[model samples]
Target: MAGLTLSQASRALGKSKSTLNRAIKTGRLSATRNEDGTFSINPAELYRAFPEPSRNTLPERPKEPDRTTVPDDLGSRISLLQQLLEREREAVADLKEDRDRWRQQATSLLANQEAAPAAPPLVKRHRWWPF
Candidate 1:
């Protein structure tokens, strides 16, 4: 006879493996052990043991809000982000300009120092000692 494994029987009957095992142990349902020591239950025997529940008998769950709806404050958030980005860009440009001006001033000062002449060494005259 055709049969279903314990896992298949559990899925069909909406019951757990342990529950079905208990039922078999209590002699409520019949199953045969396979060569691999696994139980195979006949589908007819399973239904005879536990009838399927009626459809639409379960309570309906509360519905969640749809994800497709756009948030009301999205436009304002985008504008705020854009303003922040512009401020950051302006600050970076100002920093770059200041850095260039300082670099030019340093270069000019170095060049002028190099072009200037070196000071002459001081000459020292030693007076002869009269004996």
Candidate 2:
């Protein structure tokens, strides 16, 4: 009556009710049956049967990485990225210039072709055959 009930004992011991019930039934843990048919286990006996888990044996969680601190190579990485962007811009400019030069050469060639006179047809040479 003054001791922990089955549920309370199981919760405090971090074990299931069935486990404690089995322990009590198997005589590994001693408990008094109350008039209401619920088991009342003594804290001393429960601790003796299943000792409290030691906190020291658990591994400590690693501390979270600090986001505010800047890395040592930040400046170098930014400079390298800037240099790459500049190189890409220069390459694009060169490609545009080459494209314009090619377009100009093609238009000139077409103009020259149109300006040349057309050759006369061979109708006179074939006229003797008659229609």
Candidate 3:
């Protein structure tokens, strides 16, 4: 029977190669091994194992309004951009605060370690002679 190689089947089914391998390993799908040690799977079997989503099953997305329908005022555009910039600046401040906190914690930990007494090296007793 006509069939597709593993790569071809993966593309057709929108699945990863590992997923197909797992399906074959679990006996949910069957594939033939080529002489060169590559797997070839029947397209029908791939579809059976991983059915494509039906067109009718997918929810329809709302259409976007036409660009010409929207107002193109310069002040409105500037306000929107300013709002985005403010949000990004706030995000940067938050990140900087977190970094400073972590830095303080790490330095405090290091200070505490340095203040503590050092542990003595272990001394090993040598045997008088080998048995």
Candidate 4:
């Protein structure tokens, strides 16, 4: 009556009742077998074998927004997205300008380059020593 039941222990530990029952049967955890054939687990004993789960283990649920603030929230989000889009467009325009400037420089350098004169052909000479 004082201690936690198997189901209660399972819920607190974020595990199944069958798991706790198995632990008790396998001597991994200690529990009392009640007259009604239910387990009466001591909080200390249960925790000693299986520590309570940390708060970080549970997933966080998002809070629902107020109905009246929904429209304002949407407006703010849209404005922020628009600002980001404008910044991205400006960056792309700057990159395009740089690319155009580089292309013009390359074409000008190629056009101004002078061709080198061709070398004269060499005549073959006969060697006197065969070795």
Encode model 4's per-residue lDDT on 1-118: one tens digit a residue. 4889998999999899889988999999999889999989999898889976763344433556763334545667789999999999999999999999999999888776634455
* 43-117 per-residue lDDT for model 3 (tens digits): 878878787757324343444676323333544777999999999999999999999999999999999999999
TM-score, prediction 2: 0.41
TM-score (C-alpha, index-matched) for candidate 1: 0.41
Q: For residues 55-114, what per-residue lDDT tens digits would candidate 1 score against the true structure?
A: 323433344477443344664677899999999999999999999999999999999999
TM-score of each: 0.41, 0.41, 0.40, 0.40
Q: What is the alpha-carbon RMSD of candidate 4 to the true structure?
A: 13.3
**Every model's Cα RMSD, please?**
19.8, 20.9, 12.9, 13.3
Q: In candidate 4, residue 125 scores what lDDT?
A: 77
Best by TM-score: 2
lDDT ranking, best first? 2, 1, 4, 3
Indicate the residue-level lDDT of 105 in model 2: 100
Instruction: Report the number of clashing residue pairs per model.
Output: 0, 0, 0, 0
